[model samples]
Target chain A: MEIEKPYLLFLGDAPDALAAKTAQGIVDWRRDWCVGQLRLPGCLADTGLPDLDIATARARGGKTLIVGVANAGGVLPPHWAAPIVAAIAAGMDVAAGLHMKLADNPEIAAAAAKHGRRLFDVRHSTERFATGKGVKRPGKRLLTVGTDCSVGKKYTALALERAMTARGYHADFRATGQTGVFISGRGVSVDAVVADFISGAAEWLTPANDPDHWDVVEGQGSLFHPSFAGVTLGLLHGAQPDAFVVCHEPTRTRMRGVEHRLPTIREVIDLTVQCGRLTNPDIRCVGIAVNTERLSDEEARRVIAETVRAEGLPATDPVRFGVEAIVDKIAEEFGLP
Target chain B: MEIEKPYLLFLGDAPDALAAKTAQGIVDWRRDWCVGQLRLPGCLADTGLPDLDIATARARGGKTLIVGVANAGGVLPPHWAAPIVAAIAAGMDVAAGLHMKLADNPEIAAAAAKHGRRLFDVRHSTERFATGKGVKRPGKRLLTVGTDCSVGKKYTALALERAMTARGYHADFRATGQTGVFISGRGVSVDAVVADFISGAAEWLTPANDPDHWDVVEGQGSLFHPSFAGVTLGLLHGAQPDAFVVCHEPTRTRMRGVEHRLPTIREVIDLTVQCGRLTNPDIRCVGIAVNTERLSDEEARRVIAETVRAEGLPATDPVRFGVEAIVDKIAEEFGLP
Candidate 1:
């Protein structure tokens, strides 16, 4: 079967010069190959795209894909997802460099499924590839920590990263969400798809020096934050990090009330593992990070560790507990040691 | 205008038997005084009532009000705000027992305008009333401390309350939003509406006392938290707290990106004051409560005091400066001394 060219769709405030340059680059790069590339030029309509140009693009090749580069800031609007999905179903690889997740839009997900094209969230992808180091082999074991927005996941991850570096391990902090550069430090740059590719490439990367100098990539947000979640899932699928670290905090009242009913950490962890399995089936048992405020450090660690362990998984204290100890436990559990 | 029965809207899951019984008691008591009180039957949508058998009941005409009582566990869909506003505008004085605030839903402000009724979030109305008793005296001064959720607002308020009580004046902790029940052995509740009514009733209830009792209310969540912000605003409007103790950390990163965008403490203070004016026009300058997390006691106090005074307002360290110092400064400002 002669593969059709990739279809790219651009959304958001009018494309900037950089985006145009990137698009032209991709088109030119594909010109030398047998791959055909086309761009869809129109805003998504309320009833979905009914334009004839889109149809022509689909007819030219069964590989109709929509690539959208939007700077709308947050998540892609649900309405925009429908047209992209339609374009994808017409046989195209749909790629969006939206700083947000499109998975939040069911229509987009459904459309992606119909088109057999994966929905790649660009935020995590951009973060993974921020330093443009591309994918490199790990010199040691790598672990990534992630959480939902406002959940104190980054602080926990940073604390872990600091802990690992203190142990004389060559550690690097890789941020995977809408996290700007200053927060995550300079590291490799990989888009969502590319991060997954790099994760697969990790198997062939450089061998670990101390077997612990591996990297610690921080997942940006929860499985619910549009872009962050998808990238986390993709990385988990591709890289199969030694262990997943979950950070969570109880809502204010501590008492789960009617409207403010809080989801238990166990439920959240279970859901996380389940979601990760969709992308990668080899996720090991989860570890939990509890933001300690109001509770004393000792008490917070003990309580969270006990709760997580009771949920039938190994849990470690992200605060008082050293990262080396945590990694060791995870290594033992995953047979990495 | 012929007066009509008043109603109360209860939003929540099925009210507990105790709550339902308490509600019925209020209705029965009001009935004896010819104040016809009715509860929204079953769900909120059941707006129709069995033809008011008014022939058998004596007329107690004041206003026709709608009261809704809902279980705390029920999900009050966002759309419910529209009907709630409509019920309030249709000359129905809607009084809800559960906590409701504009901060909880930014859309509430717009929806309230659509129905020509302003949203009066009373999440802490009950708690405010319970604590106002301690400060209920003619010419008695009241003060409040607030912050976004989890910023140590409760501790600041409690500490201030203790400081006032230790000074031979009646001082109590008033609940504004997230705070509830026995703190430092004082009965604290987070009810703003009830506090306002209690404040009004206290003046008439106790004429012999100096009315120098101070009520300290604690606010929850950041300025953006939907429930806490509205509760803070409502309490300020109703109680007209004599002064505000702004609890904050000394670190620059504490402001997140707000410091760069909003830029100076004066701008932040002015923005707070402007928002407060939406609920009350009489708020005086605010003081500062520095969280002593990473700072030494003296350093924290000095920085907080300097920051507060820099805004041209009185500032005191809750840890080093003591509540007495704060009260003394505020009293002097109000010419109480």
Candidate 2:
């Protein structure tokens, strides 16, 4: 029922969404199950990631081709569908996180069926959710709230989950979006819910019965964003988190889809904290997570150091520098051994 | 086809939800379209609403029995099925706004089907929504926000809508919850949406194409409410209203389902204005709509007088005194004729 071994391919190109998260997840976390990546000639050449043809990929123990890029709008372009069809024809299964499922598209479905290839539409989880009561759930729920939408909230949350588990603290990643679903294979896409039940949807995702466990609810939107701020607040309220990490991409100026510039990290933290108090007054900000992809290693560290100094919280590039500081902060607050 | 004439029944019970909003709506706003009321035993006696048995209701020009009263959990209680069955057997079409649809239950569905009676589930409307891009919508939006959930947002908005039209403004009521939908027959329940798409759902409902038309959005939940505040913020962003009216239930000491006390009228107005500016910086709070249901008419006037004097904006019990003050405020702000 599942592809045990797979050759992940970007095929044509990768969108800037999720910051190439799907590809990186397969490459770094599931590398043992990965055969190698298959890309067009000169495509993804300089990244030092493995680039193989469909034939060579299968020859090196690949059983399927998992298309890894989550492009903008999540639609599989007509041109890219051909390459995916070619992979199915080459006797390998194909998987994608596109919003348009291959199983739903007649052309892709026919090609997939003809080759008897398995398809994985990892964009959304089919979990039937109950209404969220926003009861006091046990086990230190922590969420990664961001300064803007898509500013590494998921990335840092996942990294912190890994770091926490690495330090022997039991933690889990609750996926909020498709990229998170592709990586974790779980979580309700909160934004897709009907407005009346958003809080209930949040309650359903992280129920109120455990004291010794931690639920890392994935955050969505930004409090400052004119368009997506509601989702941001909903996730904040839904999680009812005990502690949180403020995720920020330092290079951005204006908020997405709006004319206003981004709020200061302190302002975002203050807004988040103020909003969090609406549900739980004791909620705390554990750390600051800065996305440093645009900066050099030295610059990233300097920016993080400055953020830590200003915010009076431990700060880090969760992906580049690891989430140990933030994880440790959570562990200390929750009295994890 | 809509039923030309119908009796809207609260059925077995009228829960506090919507403050029996479904029944009150028919009696208050849609009186011309309503035939009479049907209740089980001693319910709804003092309201002077017409209480009719299924047979008598039919004789009195009732063609359908609408199951009113959005019950606590929106579930139809077991005992009410008998009365509903009697209505169906009487050749009366039944309509309900419960989350539990009549068509979903075998007993109710079969009874209605066998009797050739129609069923109307008016609580939910299915609209394919697009992601809110946070773009500037063209028309001016005026939302009625509240200090607590169910204080009087919909009622105030509806009254303002009437007053605006009476004054020759191109105004419309955009309902955001079930009661609003029952009254207006349109609007997406913003709370039922997935977390990420709440803003989008709002955007899809009010597309950005008109400048002269004004949308009086019926708001849900207070920004401080623990149970459903996210929907409040989402509606704010989705509507991106240029002006707002703060609705307050002055007698509310504590917020719903929480230990937190309600904020002051000034605080509520400030918070609504601050959050509204997240999407539209020029957003303004035109006036206050006081829900003086707990106060006597004279007492209500005194409270309104006190509020208007203190807040320096016109304040009124919209249902009793009408929304002329708030409507005039909106009219002045937008330079409406």
Candidate 3:
């Protein structure tokens, strides 16, 4: 949201289904700054922003061209390099979360250097993490648990952290993914790490050194995401959180790239608690953090109310209604000042 | 067991307790080819071999001085280098399991070069591991479980692999530690990897691509060993073993270097199963692989008998009784040839 200039999201060759992820995330989460979006031919008109080509978008005062997809394996598709280079030449700063570096390519490097434009490689990390060791450090942790990957986990964590801080609590946001890393200026991208060290990485990020502070640890993939469940388990064990907030996108019908339908909110909350208590027997799911981006504000509130009644857990649409209710609940439960 | 030349174990300034782990392991496991033991002032005398200085040991036909301590953090102690260099100058080869390599130090490198002696850095590995995507691979895995660190996990694994091989089963020993790396000449050191990648290293070592083979995956740290339990869980998950054999040194009164008493054999078996079943629900603890090195033969048999009777698991000392009973049980359970 620190975007000082209007932007164009370049979704090169990303199929129609994935447009709702990174591209639509910008439109839904940070929409005000986006002037337009560029997509391949015949892709769905989901962004709702004006569609513009590279030259037209630049002329329309789109000073930043964002590569709006964190592709699987985080590998940058080589086909997008040409359009990105042209954007740099047109004096637009470029940003991508892919593992491949624009600085490594000579053509893109020279153009960016000539235009004095910056390229932000979001996924490359320079942090070292020690073993978690399951140390009983002071302070309680509030980890955001998710029913699926990218289900407003970071957004909810940041929102809760902000709300807690505003209410005069010593709260810290612990990032666990690329976007979170960019926002926080520091974090380990838990997904990019090797399998065994997932818990250790999570443990390093959310150290419980102060009894009064709440470390709002961001969640990564979910217990149901087939490709990323191990990381979920690792993070759960490593955090050893005293309490958790379960996150879910209510509109989603199935887990990503699989045939199975999504589990009920109650089932997911129970599963999240079970997974967390595997390493931390004292962990409890305190409430639900619902992602209602796809629904109207009125519908979001309805869904939130329904979830709270159905699961008998306090639930909130933090993005819509603010996180104070959930924050106060946590403060009351943990005796946070 | 493959030593063609008489060896001297150099326990340079190592305390008695740790020396018993590595030096006595060499004496007890591969004792036939060793000629003497070397120690500095105030260091313990646990090796029970003839005491010899550098020149005397070399003159007495000790052509290789093995560094007999795998220190915590795998870092080489600085004081050990001088004696190691002196031993190399006296026509002895160098061997060490420390993460810090004597071969990487220019002074030691020059000394070894001038003496035409080889420097063996047992822990510095050049292997890469892929992520262990939870797939039900073809082969049945046989992982060694342990009651504590350095309680003969690798020894049990190697012994079982050897026995199975000798009996004409297609068995492979997949090592996960420094000593096993030296014995095998190749392996990813699972402990040295960052917290997230332990399981991937195990998977890379024991690819279950052939259903007819029995992959004997070497265990690293124990499930209850505080500092390294994450690694044990990762290896177990990565191996996805159908059956496992527990490795225990009956004399271990406490978990290594920790105040907690060792878990009973049955408790450890249950703990091992629970930890492994975190990723693989079907993993079973099939039998017990005992290390009777510290006990008299009669006492060793008594402990083994007690464990077998109490736990209802077949038990054997692969060194004293050979691994036939355990191997035969595995073959029968899996209906293997």
Indicate which candidate wins on DockQ: 2
Candidate 2: list runs displaced more than 4 Å: A1-27, A30-130, A207-213, A257-260, A327-336, B1-24, B32-124, B207-213, B257-260, B331-336
Best by lDDT: 2
Question: Each candidate: what lDDT?
Answer: 0.43, 0.75, 0.73
**In model 1, which runs have C-alpha deviations exceeding 4 angstroms?**
A1-14, A18-68, A71-85, A91-337, B1-37, B40-218, B221-329, B333-337
> How much is the lDDT of residue A329 in candidate 1?
55
Query: What is the lDDT, from 0 to 100, of the residue A276 in candidate 1?
Result: 40
TM-score (chain B) for candidate 1 is 0.46
lDDT for residue B288 in candidate 3, whole number 0-100: 91
Residue B86, model 2, lDDT: 86
> Of 2 and 3, which scores higher on DockQ?
2
Q: Tens digits of per-residue lDDT for model 1 on A1-337?
A: 1123444334333345444332333332233221233333543211122224446766654353434344445456555565676666666655444545665567777877765676545344332211011122334334444334455554555666666566555665555432312233222222222321333322222223454555566554333222222233334433435456766664333211111223466555665564344323455544666656657777777776676667655455555554455555555664442
lDDT tens per residue, model 3, B1-337: 2223577888777766665466776676457667888888877656788889888887778877888876677677677778888988888887777757888888899998898988866554445555556556787788988888877788888888778888888887776766565455456677665444566667777775677888888887766554455567677777878889888888879777545567677767776675565445688877897889889999999989998898887898888888788877876787766
lDDT of 3 at A19: 44
DockQ, candidate 3, comes to: 0.13
lDDT of 3 by residue, A1-337 (tens): 2223577887776666464366665566457778888776556545778878889988888887877765567666677778888888888988666767767777778889899987766554445555556656687788988887768888888888878888888888887776565445457777665444566777777776778888888987666543455566678778878888889999999776544456677766776665455456678777888888899989998999998898777898887777777877787787768
lDDT of 3: 0.73
